[model samples]
Target: MTILKAMVLYKQEPIENNPLIYSDIDKPEPGHGEVLLRIRCCGVCRTDLHIAEGDLRPIKLPIIPGHQVVATVEEVGEGVQEVRKGDRVGVPWLYWSCGRCKYCRRGLENLCDNALFTGYSVDGGYAEYMVAKADFVHPIPGFFDDRHAAPLLCGGAIGYRALRLTGLLERGEGSLGLFGFGSSAHMIIQVAINKGLDVYVFTRGEQRQEHALQLGAKWAGKPTDESPIKLDAAIVFAPAGWVFIEALKKLDKGGRVVLAGIYMSPVEKLEYSLLWLEREVKSVANVTREDVREFLKEAAQAGVRTEITIYDLKDANKALQDLKHGKLKGSAVLKII
Candidate 1:
């Protein structure tokens, strides 16, 4: 019964209350088809905040909450192929999806009913060690260091999925609106800029707006502010449902709004006019393995760089607290290694 230090949540509470307790727990071993990883870094996410505050119902209690994990494979279990010890890998939100499910068979594993989520359903990387399904983890790109790669596993991958859902790529070129300037949206804007899309950003914070401008946004203002031009597509990264409605108001006819949050507040009742004229709304679900792979490649090619604020492993609560209050300028990463 080897012990390892972890920030564990015994119960859900407000992030301000410091719900995560740092303690020594039994270090997990690599089960069959799984691998043991020595965590290097983990990115703090809004989803982690939601789980802390009980916005999203917990699937498992006493969980170690961190999904954006960058680690080195320390050992491989029986029947594990392709992944070897000493490989640097990343574990994302979608931990495992039953391949035999109908949704998985149809290549919609992100929507698999029998899916297990890292950090949510099982223990995740807010620790010195953890075990993950070998087939589910992805090899981190050589160019990105551990801290930088952490955010890409979740924010970059999911944000990329939201961008694709907007149908902007198929349309070739168009104006794109991002309704937040946080971790995910910032990364998405870089990719959108690379595609030659005119990016407009809507966020409340002055610094965030400036950050958006610095990242090549054509326009940056509050969510309530009117866009200079009608947008062909918009992605709302804020958890507040009102931001979703605001994006719709600025959309051109037949444009789409893709909501990127894993858990969002109840949306305000939408007027029929917002949905009229083929204006569409869609939500980004969990990321599939394909989404992760594709996003990593695209991010690497686009030279997507993350603005990160570093934290220590024992200070997971503080990291998430800053995240909840919007104190973080960019992604918050725990430097565990």
Candidate 2:
């Protein structure tokens, strides 16, 4: 029985306590319609943090947690035809959705009730190898290398979904506000700017603010600081609910606020006036296969680049701790190969 080294979560606990246990598990084989990947790297996400710390209840215990995966196909199972061995692919958060569900029929597979999410509902790519649904994996464009491509699978795809939900794409031109300047925002700001939107970034750290400016954001300031102009739309990537409100405060009358986090702190009571106009608040549930495909193409065209901090696969716990404490300047990637 061949074994593979993986970071497994036996239980949820504070990331400070380092809950992921390093272990040698039996190597997984590709099932029917699945493809086995030799994982090159996995991007550490805030969702991983939430799952690790118990903010998002565990669906599968002793699971390997990482969704933003960049890998090469090492083998394919029965009925898998779209990809062959050595093909580079990316596995995102939305692993597989029941095509017969109402939401799936409506082309809203991101909201499918019977969906199995990578890393949360199933073992993900924080290891040497993983098996993923062949139909769900996206071909990693040659525009990005393994490390840089990992963040795009989730951080970029979900951010693109949140941006689309904000209705900025419909307008073609407007002031766009980003409430957090972490992994997603940094990449999204580049796309927004390329689309001719005036990008305003609100984050806590001076270093993050400068990073936003460097990424072509028109304005960068703390969440509490007033933007130079009212935003036509905003996306809150921070897990704090207060930042959601802050983005709302900077929005124009008909603007929408899209919450991008999988888990966030409880929002305070809303003042009626803050939402009195045609304003709307929506939460991004997850990403669809279309979202991943479109985002990858658009991001490549826009020359979107992810600034990453690399960590050895064994140092995943430290990566999550840094993410929780705002210690990372950009995305964090676990190098598995």
Candidate 3:
């Protein structure tokens, strides 16, 4: 058995106080249908921040916190056919789903009752090596490098899923509004442009607005500011409650607004008139593997771009701190081995 160095979080605490310790652990071996991967990069998501701060309780202690992983297969277990040794792959938040569930039977595995989440429910990619079910690993597109593709596994894929939840993919010539200009919104903006839809962004900070504009958003303004045109669909990535109301107010008749974050401030008060015009609000949960496949293909073709700040694997805590404080412009990634 080989020993590998990894950053392990034994307890939930602020990142600044050495919440995660760098230690040696036995490298995980491929299981019955799993593949051992030599992790190269892992993206730090807001969910990770939540877990670290105890906002989301840890499913297991001494866990390695990461899911948006890019790695190369080092070994393959029996019964694995989709991936081979030395193949580059990406691991997402959805680790596995019970195929016997009604949701899985209906090809809606994202809602599976027995779904397992990487990093959340199992050991994840915050190490030199990790293992995953071969069928769950997605092939990285040739156009993206490991660091660049890391964020796409979760932020990009889930954002794409949120967009799909809006039913915008089937609709034509509809205005799309993104209620936050984070990494996900950046990718979504490009996709909207490729689909020939106008893009509007609502965010509080000036920097995010500039980023939205740079990504070809037709209009960008603070949440308090109003858009000149109503939106056919909107996606809210910000966890702030007020943004949701602002986005709802900007929706056209029969429009939809998808809430993309895992947790958000409570919607204390909302006027029914805002939703009385046949407008609807939907929430996006964990993504299906099919969503991963489709989003990666479309992202590759749309020339989706990611803005990332890189940190060494041992600096995973720093990455989380930066993400928590909103110091990074886009996504924060930790380069392992």
Q: What total of clashing residue pairs does each candidate reach? A: 0, 0, 0
Local distance difference test scores for all models: 0.92, 0.92, 0.89
Q: Residue 288's C-alpha lDDT in candidate 2?
A: 95
| TM-scores, all models, native as reference | 0.93, 0.93, 0.96
Residue-wise lDDT of candidate 2 within 1-337, one digit each (tens)?
A: 7888999999999998989988999989999999999999999998899899998989999899999999999999999999999999999999999999999999999999999999999999999999999999999889999999999999899999999998888788998899987778888988888888899889998988998888888889999997899988999999898888888888899889999988789988778788978999999989999999989988988999898999999999999999989788678999998
Give the lowest summed-lDDT range of ten residues in model 2. Answer: 267-276
RMSD of 2: 1.8
What is the lDDT, from 0 to 100, of the residue 147 in candidate 1?
A: 91
In the range 141-248, model 1's lDDT, one tens digit per residue, is 887888988899998999999998999976769999999887888888988888878999999989889999998999999999978999999999888989888999
Model 3 lDDT per residue over 1-337, tens place: 8889888889999777868889899988888999999999999998888877788878888898899999999999999987989999999999999999999999889999999899888889888998899999999889888898988999999999998888878875778989988889888888878877788999888978888888898889987797879889999999888899999999999999999998789987999999997999899998999999888888888889888999998888888888877698679999886
- How much is 247 displaced in model 3, in angstroms? 1.1
lDDT of 3: 0.89
Q: Which stretches of model 3 miss by more than 4 angstroms?
A: none
